[model samples]
Target: MIETQDLRKEFRDGRTTKVAVDGLTLAIPPGRVTGLLGLNGAGKTTTIKILATLLRPTSGTVRVDELDPLRDPKAVRHRINLIAGGERMVYARMTGRENLWYFGQLYDVPRAVLGPRIDELLALVGLTGAAGTVVERYSRGMAQRLSIARGLINDPAYLLLDEPTLGLDAPIARDLRRVVARLAAEGKGVLLTSHYLAEVEELCGHVYVIGDGRHLTEGSPAELTARTGGHRTVRVTVPGASPEVEAAVTAFAARAGTVAGLDRAGDGALVVSVSHPGEIAGPLTMAIVGAGGTLAGLEVTEPSLEDAILALNDAAWLVTA
Candidate 1:
């Protein structure tokens, strides 16, 4: 639903020019959550602003649903909703219901439909009880919920959520995640940007990692994990002494890919990482036994989103090895 080719945004100072985003080519599919993840000052906000039609890209082309945002800003606004990070708050003086009603009116939602939409969104975001209370009195979580309701005022086809769960408590963050999933399931294309790697992994089917104002990598969570080629770590603790087990792990490491790293603690415990996690149990076990080791317990560790992100951060290793 969204595509950008060689997107670049540049800022000029007295003598130096800085590129906030450079050569960023990306595609966000319909009915899927696509995460734009990066650390602070990594150009996430700049990218989102350009996509939302609030800022024009310095170079390249951007199309949302085949509409050029720069040429048809009005039409683009009608089709997208952007709940900016740290800024999804309603008018503090207006009641939650009033805030929703006002935003709905701006979206041209008919007065007859406004009431029902307000009620539905308030309930959807778990703010039904505070619908009548002024936003100024609402807690941070309540205001965040109301902001979400405002974003849905137009029932937008594309949702741009920048840190939707930034300041919420755990419970509220979980609730927001559920809401985000439901929106996508309803066929809304979503571009979500957040610092929370776990949240992005849970919500986004695909992700684009940005670093140093450039596109570092883009792929599904599993695909990116596989590309990193980091060894999968396995931890084992056996009750009795087993010298054979040590030899087995080393041999499995060599054949499976590379042990890469190993850590042994007191009490006959071993932590082993082989090039591939799939060979951890069967091949590793046999090797341990051949060395006269008896297995008492075994646990496998798979690559996480954090591991993939770390690999993205290492510029020297990217697209090289």
Candidate 2:
């Protein structure tokens, strides 16, 4: 398990001091994937670096498997692997097999054991056929595959993947996602940061949204969506609508826990907010007709994860304002 309490990190550049992470608290339990999401300069990388023990937090408590990172940097490092996308960490001059062997040696894996381990990792990453090929000859996807192999060479219990599928074609990205899922299934805690919200929604069991070096919200995708008011917008057009029909629809909306607003489509339409349009569409239509209003048209629009994130940011801005 990984846990952080009131984590904060700041950098100083001569006269300027920049806070990268501000009192961010989170946890990553074993056998699950946790997603860290944010725009540029949102402190995702900073938080990851601190957890990886590459950078020390200015103030906070960081523990990996009940071990403090600052007090036990080497031990903490041994339990975590940080795999960053768009990083050419492997030597282009060496074969894929050689690169893994080299990293295994760095981790002090015995040569007798390292050979078979390298073979296993190459096979695990589906790069066995290209194991003898030089990394310089490998494509971008192949290089990323090798990078993942390197990260696993140490057999760490925790993994940090930063944009693991960045700049990949659809099929390749899907394949990598499968690999990541397998890792999590193997009982490793995985912390993932990605620009692809769909990927996060598919893989992550829990997600954290951060903005301007602070955490905005954290929960399962469904919970965050509901919390951010990411509901379906249903527009019901009623021809020659009367005040009675409007009042009935308004009452229905309030009962459904949503606000009904008047639409100036010039067709006397009412825009209703709802978590699920199917749950209320038929009932609303029937109610309007019962009130002597003709249902001319209806439209339903569902919100996306992008919409949820934007709403979170907007709320954060309002709070800080």
Best-matching candidate per TM-score: 1
Model 2 stretches astray by more than 4 angstroms: 233-280, 283-302
Per-candidate Cα lDDT values, in order, are 0.82, 0.86
lDDT of 2 by residue, 107-199 (tens): 888888888889998987789999999999999888988998898898889999888887777887898898889889999999999989989
Q: Write the per-residue lDDT of candidate 1 for residues 209-320, one digit (tens) a residue.
A: 8886688888887887788775466665544535556666666677666653555657645655454646566666667667766666777777787888886777534553
Model 1 off-target regions past 4 Å? Answer: 242-244, 247-278, 290-294, 316-321
Backbone clashes in candidate 1 total: 1
- TM-score for every candidate vs. truth? 0.87, 0.81
Worst 10 residues of 1 by lDDT: 235-244
